[model samples]
Target: MIPVLFLSTVLIWGTTWLAIALQAGPVPVLVSVFYRFALAGILFLFILAVTGRLRLPKREHQVWLVAQALCLFSLNFICFYHAVHYIPSGLESLIFSLSTIFNALNARIFYGERISGKVILASLLGISGLVLLFGRDILDADASGTLTGVGLAMLGTLFFSLGNMVSRRNSREGISPVFANAWAMSYGAIVLMLLIILTGTPLIAPPDATYLGALLYLAAIGSIVGFSTYLILVARIGSARAAYATVLFPIIALGLSTVFEGYVWHWTGFVGLGLALLGNIVIFAPSRRPRRTAPIAKDAETVASS
Candidate 1:
């Protein structure tokens, strides 16, 4: 079951990167994102309702839900969607692999949690890996698009980390993620709709068969089923082990990107990929606790003395 859950999540999420790539033509980023989340959000609500798990958040909690909607569903995706236009899907996924590091930092800032040195080390490795992978683009004066994409991807990961912070609070307050997610996604869609209206963007149907197929795949498989199975996987094997899926999925995304997008991989990029994955593994790897020796019991001492 764990293996199934794990494999399903990796495949679903990995392929979603390609789906996002396929969504590049015709539709505006905001509209495409709106379509993805709105469809998924509706299905999320339906599933929750059918399962008798639909619970609206309290008034106070609604603010957090809104914050989550903006961070996770709206702006977070806006960055990713925009970034994909400039970079390979696999590269973006590789950059996003830093969400674990971002989450740890955000938690420390928001909740006064202590960060371990291991996390710091992991951050260095991951960031260094990214530098190696993109150094040529950064050095090139003409690669403005690449730079923009990298910045957007980093920003998107930061937003994702912030959303995770909100989610942790919601979870602690006994709000089922399934329930909170339903409302957040609905709120996200509503917000996007409002944005569309305010910006006077035209509503267009999926312009091509590929676009339509990608949109539906992202909504149903990537958003709904992927999230559901991942949550269950986290519950069963624990978050640490489940997080291993993160490291695995980017490889799949990169493989697909190579086949579909004609992504060229320099030799250094492979080394960078290894370091980035290693860093994440280091972040989640179980810490070795020093075992304390037990003291001799008083009764045993007395018996020996006597």
Candidate 2:
């Protein structure tokens, strides 16, 4: 089950990056974003209602749900869509992959989770690998756009990590991930609509098939399916481990970029990819022995008596 969820997330999200790049021209970014969640939110609500799985969130859960919406569905995506304008989709994915490290640090701060030494080492290796992958791009004379893209991608990743914390909290409170996501996406769409109204970005749809197709794909496969499977992993495993999906997905994104976007791979890029994947392996490798449970004198005595 874990493997299924992990692979599904990687394939779905990996492909979504190119879809996001497709969403760029003609339609306003905010409007396109709103379109995605509005459609996805409607679909999720309809499915939940038909299945009798939709329920009103408790007042206590509502606040975190709103936070999740703002972080995960709203600002995070806005930053990413805009960032892709300044960078290649594959490079954008690599930056987003930093979310694994961000999730670990955020989990440590918010949930008192331990950051294992191996996790820390893996994060460093991953960062180094990314630096190698982007070293030439960074050294280019006209790299202000690249820097801006990196900054936006990092901000998006931070928001995503924050959202994971909220999701973790909601899971502990027994809120269904599907239900929470439905509401969160709805709220996020509402927020984006407000932004569009405020900024007066015209709510015009692009008549282009490519843009419309990508939007539908993002709404259905990317937002609804991808997020549900991922949050389930967060609930079943830990957020830090679940976020390791980011590490693996970039390889897929790069492969797609090579095929579709004419992405040229250097030997250094291959080495960097290997290092990044190695980092994931290091973080996920099983510990030698499980932590010991507390000694139970009564159980021991009962066993002896028997």
Best candidate, lDDT = 2
Runs of candidate 2 with Cα error greater than 4 angstroms are 290-306
Identify the candidate with maximal TM-score. 2
Query: For residues 164-198, could you state the per-residue lDDT of candidate 2 as single tens digits?
Result: 99999998898878889999999999999999999
Clashes by residue pair, model 1:
none
Q: Candidate 2 — worst ten consecutive residues by lDDT sum? A: 135-144
Superposed by TM-score, candidate 1 places the C-alpha of residue 175 at a distance from the truth, in angstroms, of 0.7
Q: Write the per-residue lDDT of candidate 1 for residues 1-306, one digit (tens) a residue.
A: 866887899899889878887888778888999999999999999998899887767988999889879987898998988887787555676678677567666767887867778767876777677666655544652365888888999999888778777776777777766777788888999999999999998888898899989999999899888876765654454333454465567767767867976768999879988887787678667899876444447667878999
Backbone clashes per model, in order? 0, 0
Candidates in order, TM-scores: namely 0.83, 0.90
